[model samples]
Target chain A: MISNPLFFVFIVVLIIWIGIALLLFRIDRKISLVEKEVSEALDEK
Target chain B: MFLYRLVYVLMPIGIFLSLLWVPPANILGDASRILYFHVPVAWVSFLAFLVAGLHSIALLIKKSEILYREAMAYNSAAIGMVFTVLTVITGSIWAKVSWGHFWNWDPRETSIVILMLIYIAYFSLFSALKSNPNRWGISSVYLIISMIIAPFLIFIVPRVYPSLHPDTIINQDKKIHLEASMRITLFFLVVTFTLLYGYIYKITNKLSLIIIKLRSSHDI
Candidate 1:
């Protein structure tokens, strides 16, 4: 009963979604950091 | 900012609906839940590719400045490639559950594989042309050609060749095969995925713009 492949499939999908969400969040954060740095550089100029 | 927060709320609801709220299909059972993710991701991939293709056309026509349009096309293609890969992954899992195999060279499967290869080739060409003086012109032409072929690969080939894939929402009879609850849930998920794609596209484009700005300022 505990070995149902359906359960595994659901888990796999959930994991994929979580991974994608994390990747997007990371990209957004990194881009924000870069933008801040660029604006600061422009301001200094 | 409000839109970003909206995604936070809506995506969770979409997840909840797909994983818990929607009833199982009569035959595929719980495996049917993957449809919510697979279909939306595939749709977004197509949308992203379309955006890329349109930008390519505009780039060729305007010829004013290549950077912005080229960047937009690049970003859109990148997103399209990512989403297409996701579609394949989710579709494969669904297939494993239903077809007892991950792949069997079904027409629908073959078409998607061909689509993936096309985009992969595009990326390879893009990188290979990095130092070429006419990179923008060459890549734009390539993207335009890809855009022309995309529809045939996605829609026509799948229908013309017999497929093991299930009937689409609008089949030959021009009727929806989904139940009301399923249809609504699918629609909600699609909208959520589209919004998610839009959000990603906006940020990525902004990043490109900022980089261009920085580069121009540096040149000055």
Candidate 2:
């Protein structure tokens, strides 16, 4: 329903920003997993 | 990490401010809005190249180098390539709407395309030699050479040749072209995007290190 083209851009950018945030969160979780596993291996050694 | 989270929250506000507050340029009209996103992405892409280049230099100097440092150099270039692609895409879209054509083969566009090719070649070269023991050294050298050419491609070529692209925001005289308020808006956007780039670059480098550790541990 938005007529102004700039508003469309605003919405699209918002969606893109959300998508980027989700990706960063998932990557952070993966980094945490790797950190834990490496520490555990060090402890065993 | 907290800083990273802050950028995630702040980028949206910057985007909205750019969209709602910044007035359009007299010549470029609404299409000028793309400048906020497109140019900032391009700047970050250049920053990524600089990081990779400096790391490549460090790799050459040390007799025994850190694996992740070398890997970080290459990985940052790859991430930079991603943003470079995004810049090209957004710029092309802006061009189409403003100029009524998709491909103009202007000096700036041509230079960016060449820059993209250089990054791709760096990626492909690394992939081709990744299994070899000399892979790091060889690829690092290639990145150095690419970095040498990059400044020419980015700064010199566009400026030397006549182009449809307007003079950069603050030109030689240091006089501002855009309105006073719009300058402030654009400046804030640039700052936010730079922070966005820093967050992404750090996270990506961390992830690459994680991947390296995983690979070594798995003995694959």
Candidate 3:
């Protein structure tokens, strides 16, 4: 296991996967705001 | 969103299984296990580019309704390029361990880099024609051209040319001789990575929509 090259790849992929998930929530919030405004505008029209 | 959540929950489990349970190939020893990670990311890059190319075609299909679609295509391409870069980086890591060097511009390496360059050129063209109303049509055509040549550039050229990269998984007669264990792990990884790609693609689309809305509202 210690000698497996794939073990390292697993570590790196996990890090990147977590990083993307962290950013997703922050970006998701911002986009939700825009979507809300667009819906509101349509309702007003 | 639910799929992505499920993928996240499952992917780590798959990684654990691969890392701890799977045995290495007799020829490749333990290093061959990197295929579990490397192949999936490369597959995602191909899928992302194809999706972008499809969006580009949609640009040509509709005359005045091209705005959001073009932005979607551009964002998808941007994400695809990111994945391709990751593919190269991770592959380089594997190369250093397996081949005793990081890079030698092997046939496979060169072909992937050429695809990257084409995408870079696409962005440059986009910037040059940003203000033109017909930019969408022109850019879409460019993407379509790349899409047409993509299979040849990525798969055929590397195999046809002599290289250090492994031969095609499918032989000339269309038979794959993948080991049963490795094949199963590959399938799992490919499905996991493809789901991850879908999540990112949707996120990119949402972000692009927000950016366009912000621009029209002068919120930026």
Per-candidate DockQ vs. reference? 0.42, 0.65, 0.41
Query: Per-residue alpha-carbon lDDT of model 2 for B1-220, expressed as tens digits?
Result: 6765788777888888788778888877877888888888898888889889889988888836468878789778987898899889998998898888887999889999999998888888888886898888888888888889888888888888888888776468788777777777778777787787777777777777767776777784
Q: Is candidate 2 or candidate 3 better by TM-score?
A: 2
Error of 2 at B15 (Å): 0.6
Model 3 Cα lDDT, one tens digit per residue, B126-183: 9999899789999999988888877888888887888887656765768666777778
Give the worst 10-residue stretch by lDDT in candidate 2 chain B: B62-71
Interface RMSD of each: 2.1, 1.9, 3.2
Which parts of model 1 are misplaced by more than 4 Å? A1-26
> Which candidate would rank higher by TM-score, 1 or 3?
1
Estimate, for each residue in A1-45, the C-alpha lDDT of model 1 and write its tens digit: 238555565576667777878888888888888889898989899
- Worst ten-residue run, lDDT, model 1 chain A? A1-10
Per-model TM-score, in order, reads 0.89, 0.92, 0.87
For every model in order, the TM-score on chain A comes to 0.78, 0.79, 0.55
Q: Which 10 consecutive residues of model 1 chain B have the lowest summed lDDT?
A: B1-10
